[model samples]
Target: ANNPIWLIRNGELQSFGPDKQPIGTHGGEQNPFTLHEMQLEKGDCLYLFTDGYADQFGGSKGKKFKYKQLQELLLSVHKQSADEQRRRLDETIENWKGGLEQIDDILIIGIRIL
Candidate 1:
């Protein structure tokens, strides 16, 4: 599934955009990417990521990690420091992907408005 920009504000998790790949190597007359604009307040957290994390095939029974699980994980850690959040995310995914080769590149950028 395509990845949506995840935002956490006032302890709520929200998702937006991702109509298509943000960047594509092949140039074509495809519909222009949608521009998303929003107001972020102090303590709000935003996450931008590639689909690899959620698309990863892991965990017991070797199932996909899935967006719902990823959402829950993010919500649980949005309140932590950036470094801690990074560590937890890394550890969790690694543990989940144990003994399996990674399926794709994973990139997650998390920002906390101050």
Candidate 2:
């Protein structure tokens, strides 16, 4: 992806002991995307997502959907229209989470090159 890497964390919300690592410390990489210098010709799209969207648990007793499932969902909808892709992604997350509470804030963005 050519888009900038965005990081989000909430230390106040995380529950961690003094000796243990913080919950959100591993949110993202320290550096932004290295492709910032690249220029897009046209008709390029980049999508970035956070784990919150895929880590959600639901179903009968609740279970984490995991990253593989999220990647598959993205690949399946990769060729669809941008709007449709977003809609499908949202729907998939909602369906997977069911009534479970969201564990963390989710951030996803789609950028279209012009």
Give per-model TM-scores: 0.92, 0.58
Off-target runs (Cα >4 Å) in candidate 1 are none
Tens digits of per-residue lDDT, candidate 2, 17-93, equal: 12223334466554432323334435454556556776688756698877667656655665578789889988887
Candidate 1, run of 10 with poorest lDDT = 20-29
Cα lDDT tens digits, model 1, 1-114, are: 257899999888989968754476556656767778999899999999988999999888999999999999999999999899999999999999999999999999999898
lDDT of each: 0.89, 0.58
Q: For each predicted model, how many residue pairs clash, with residues at least 3 apart or on different chains?
A: 0, 0
